[model samples]
Target: MPVSSATSTAESPPAAVPSATVPHSWEYDGTEPFPEKEPAAPRDRGERLYVAVTAAIVLAPFLALGLAGWLLWGRLIHPADIVLALVLYTVTGLGVTVGFHRGLTHGGYRAVRPVRIALAVAGSMSFQGDVIGWVATHRRHHAFTDRPGDPHSPYRYGTHLRGQLRGLLHAHVGWLFRNSRTSAARYAPDLLADRDIRAVSRAFPALCLLTLALPFGLGWAIGGTLVHALTALLWAGLVRIALLHHVTWSVNSLCHVIGDRPFRTRRHDRATNLWPLALLSFGESWHNLHHADPTSARHGVDRGQLDPSAAVIGLLERLGWVSDVRWPTPDRVAARRV
Candidate 1:
């Protein structure tokens, strides 16, 4: 439930620095050292099967967009469908941003047992992968960042224009199909050991089904027609998932390559703060600040920067649902500023 900041030396990369503030279980022992060559893509049947399933997950909703657009043209969409879509999008999006990312991955604050489990469940419904795996992959990303060991860095190709273009595509979505796996045992041992979190991770497939079924059930109840249920599934289920998926992925692809870096990060780490994505990403577009100080509960520390995730954390803190929030201090922010 608690993790603190990691320490780094000028010679040591961020990945090698373990947290001094957390117990052994909570500590991220950083993945293998940076500058290691990327693993060769495995060509086994298992890898093929993994890619096939990933294609279904990533492409099915995208194909649904075409159907949804056709339905919209025919005036088949109900306002109830739009409203339901918005509601589910907000819930699942925040679940990924606040729940999977800030709370579970970085340990920005300590939530009560119920809140913690609830957030994990919510994030799981976003179709992002289970809680433990998601946290483990993200921790591995922070460890290696843009270096060779990093899983989804845009710099994986090169700094050249053509390479950057290819990398943007890879970073945005191609990385999901890769068979390179982050070890939950090494990176997220704490979550692996926790009975509650393990249970949530085990329930990821059920949550995926439930995420879609809820909209269908609600639409059936509201509109009382089979057509209504199907439309709701299209709009509120598939379309919403696609929108949130790209937005979250844009943080990995666009945020790194195309935004302002107001905060300094480790060498080769080019994470940036893209303000246009602030609202949609629930303040996670402040990627530069996050790379600078991963443990900070709030990323939009500067004035006029909107961070809805931070607001939620603040509200939870006020209600005593969470505690030990690592809100950025003035000195801390100033020190990291470019």
Candidate 2:
């Protein structure tokens, strides 16, 4: 949900690694008040178009849930639809957690070129955003954290009850509708310079189509009917997207406000470890440790914590698909604990 801010002071945890080898230098204490700003206006035609497209992406899948329920009531959902949805959800969720967030944004591991490209494409298909844009925004989130520059900090509106309520909604989904674009040139220069990642970013629209089409095609082939295909599109395509969208957004909204803060982060950085979301978010809900050590390959470092994304990275590392993985050391974890 966040990243490292300015480097820690003499009293801060020395073991924590800032993302992409950047050093934190911001001097704010945790006591600083959040600076509120006027809402952004979509003044240009392109800005309006951006808002329209974002609305379609965010709302269409959510609306599909009602239709999915209607179809479920009619007993139209087949075993094939369920299977396809599970497969796609797992693939795309890991693509975002393992690929976009940990691997690309934080530089947690060095992946083989092919594996890197494949992960980028898979993450792109998640319909979050283009690979480069997602990385840039996430990096910026880390850089500014809950301060004024954070794109979707729930604390942006201050810590009051009314402001917190409004900020939660803003962080959850309202941020997507705003035209506050994170510049890839400033935040994700590495991705911008990569030829393969650039191509994947440009192919985002095509991949969005492919993500839906694959389920439809598979369902039609397996069930031998247009009805099966349509159901699969509903369940695996739109419904799956909606679930992932809310879960990811929950990390940004709920994780910060609720859950246990086992680790210390920069001033005003209120990341928390939300266990209820751990299974669904593939370990990304271990937000406290993540903000504490942004570059660590593993977020769920405690016993009995389920982290499928970390497991996947471990598997890839063993297979020689990735190296230099910034797995959390026991001493480092202990040092950062509150």
Give the root-mean-square deviation of each candidate in angstroms. 6.3, 5.7
lDDT of 1 by residue, 1-338 (tens): 54642111111244433334233454323222223333565588988888898999999999999999898899999988999999998899888888889888888889999999998898999998999888888888888787665789887777777778878898999889876798887678778778998999999999999999999999999999999999999999999999999999999999989989999998778899999999999999999999999889899988899999999999999999999899999999999999
Off by over 4 Å in 1: 4-42
Worst 10 residues of 2 by lDDT: 1-10
Report backbone clashes per prediction.
0, 4
Q: Model 2 Cα RMSD, Å?
A: 5.7
168 in model 1: Cα distance from truth in Å?
0.5
lDDT of each prediction vs. the true structure? Answer: 0.85, 0.86
Decoy 2 TM-score against native: 0.90
Screening candidate 1 with a backbone cut-off below 3 angstroms (N, C-alpha, C), the clashing residue pairs are none
Residue 313 displacement in candidate 2 (angstroms): 0.4
How many clashing residue pairs are found in candidate 1? Answer: 0
